[model samples]
Target: MSAPRIIQVASGKGGVGKTWLSITLAEALAEMNRSVLLFDGDLGLANVDVQLGLSPKHDLGSVIAGRARLDEAITKYEIPSVSGAGGGARFDVLAGKSGSGVLSALTKAEISGITRGLKVLSDRYAHIVVDLAAGLDQGVMSLCMPGSTTLVVVTDEPTSLTDAYAFIKLLSIQEPAADIRIVVNMANDREHAWRTHAALTNACKNFLGLNPPLAGFVPRDDLVRDAIRHQTPILFRHPQAKASEAVRRLANDLLLPVPRPATIISTSSRK
Candidate 1:
């Protein structure tokens, strides 16, 4: 069988560190000798290229403009290691169209093309992690369908909680097959993060009849902001930090095999 192709990380609100986590997870998978490709699915607010500190000659713009095919627009990153020997995962980014207009509005044919492109990359790599745009944007949702594992990120605040629920609710209605993965960022501890997820999941189950799964949680840490300012991922900057550990654990958790849930979802958990 082909190497496990699973997971696509997203959040209801921006600045929830989705991009950072995607980059870090890519690195983590690479460290484990698992080839990974971090797809910049956030066509509108594409920043995975910046986070990697590399400027590509082309982006998804080339593909959308029809000037270049999907294969031509692809960029590769050869991330060097700390030791003299350097090897890292190859990052393929789809940085959206250059113009503001809805370039290549994800038609079924185009969507199939993109998914096939990702599979091609996955054949060479073990995991393909997509960094989605914040909120329930159409461009984001179109790619994060029920067939894909959707990781919804949130914070401990009330606004984040409510927004997380709303985001999942919207998605659950549009894509019933979507497996919701919850990860609470900027939490004080695992318990706090779990509480945040429980609240949001309960609300989704109660009102929308959707039961999202608990994937992982990332704690609050100053080092995350520091790494972002430095244009480096926390996993590379401070792997020992609480948040870093959480992200590492998250990578493993996401990699774990999750059996498909039965169609029936309990109403008690919905509320």
Candidate 2:
């Protein structure tokens, strides 16, 4: 059988709602009947479970330490009910290694083993969304550099744009054919979101000679925060909300048949 597709959701810096997008996208895919496994690739920071308001007993650390098997670390989270969807979505979540100590103490061999295990485990799902840690560090690059589709999340902040550029540049050097897609999150308006995408793409083209594709943008909506407060994904919590609708549209766009260098169309043009 063909292996499952893996998508690495990453950002230049933290606090760009990377995890939020990661979880919601997985939820959206699940709603479409695509069995998904959302791996909390933040490894050490492991908060995907927290965001879902779950307290997983076993994590990757447990598996690595030989205290538990990989199956034990995987948790089954039935997605929230969808109104028009056939049935409530159901997917698995592989928790990350919780705590800072585990983060620093992790060896390359251990990480390599975990990565290899992921490759074997991926065969069971339709999609594996890995929420990578921000930055171009070894841990982050190890996951992003592989043969996985990438989604770079960015905002309007100068720092966010520059850092994202720097991160993509490094990745591009390593993988010249990498047509990483850009997602502008927390954008104030259509104009602002397009500008952010343009600025980042221009820098990548002019400086690094790489032209990243613009996937889409998520507008600044209060419903996103409200859903987060309730510990539920907006895709299900308030599907009618602007942010939720945007994400669902993105979900559909992603499911379209397309090849590299021709990523999903921007949400603005789809309207």
Candidate 3:
């Protein structure tokens, strides 16, 4: 089978709704009939399991400790169709080690091992959404594959814009032709979203000599909080919610073909 598209969702700092976007995006992709796996790549301080209300028998901790195979750690999450149809979206989640800081202290070799495992597991799914830890730490950057599409989530906050610029700058240094895209979350409206994008775009173009295209924007919605509290995806619990609609649009945009660099590094090439 062909390798699955890896969507690495990242942010400069926390509390920017990065994890929520990762979960909803995975669900949206699955709804489009693609096999999806949401890999909680946050490692230490992971909360994907908490957000999804799942208690898996195996997790990344088990895999890292050699107690379980990578595939064995996967937990299936299904969302029944809101229309009461028998068929709905189903996806797998390779949860991270929650409420523990041990994974954060992993050695470089250990981090590479997990990346290798993910590459092997890529063959089983059509797309893998990796929820990266917030920041530019070594652990977070190590998992950022060159062939993956990097989505940097940002808000209108000044700190968010500044830190996002720092991240984009460093990522560009690592991979000059990296496919970095901006995702504006919790915007007031389309105009607000574009303005936010323009702010980041201007900074990148002026300083980094690059202009990362705007992937999409998600408007602020109160229902999102409710879905989080319920440990269910907004697309599943409130399909008609504004946030759900925006996420579906983002997912659809990702499905469209785009030019990629010829020097794109596949997982097999990683040492």
Best by lDDT: 3
Model 2 TM: 0.89
Model 2: residues with Cα > 4 Å off, grouped in runs = 1-4, 80-87, 99-101, 262-271
Question: How close is each model in CA RMSD to the real structure?
Answer: 3.3, 5.7, 4.9
Judge candidate 3 against the unseen true structure and give its global Cα lDDT, from 0 to 1. 0.88
- Between prediction 2 and prediction 3, the one with superior TM-score is 3
Clashing pairs in 1: 146-178, 205-270, 206-270, 206-271
TM-scores, all models, native as reference: 0.84, 0.89, 0.92
lDDT (10s digit) by residue, model 3, range 1-271: 1223899999888899999999999999999999999999997799999998889999999988999998999999887454745347889999999899879988888889888888888888899999999988988888788878889999999999988988887888788778888999999999999999999988777667777888899999999999999888889899999999999999998888765423233333222
lDDT of 1 at 168: 80
Of candidate 3, the 10-residue stretch with the lowest lDDT total is: 262-271
- Ranking the candidates on TM-score from highest down gives 3, 2, 1
Instruction: Please list the C-alpha lDDT of all candidates, in the order they appear.
Output: 0.70, 0.79, 0.88
Candidate 3 Cα outliers beyond 4 Å, as residue runs? 1-4, 80-87, 260-271
Tens-place lDDT digits, model 1, residues 174-213: 7766677787888888788778878887777678777677
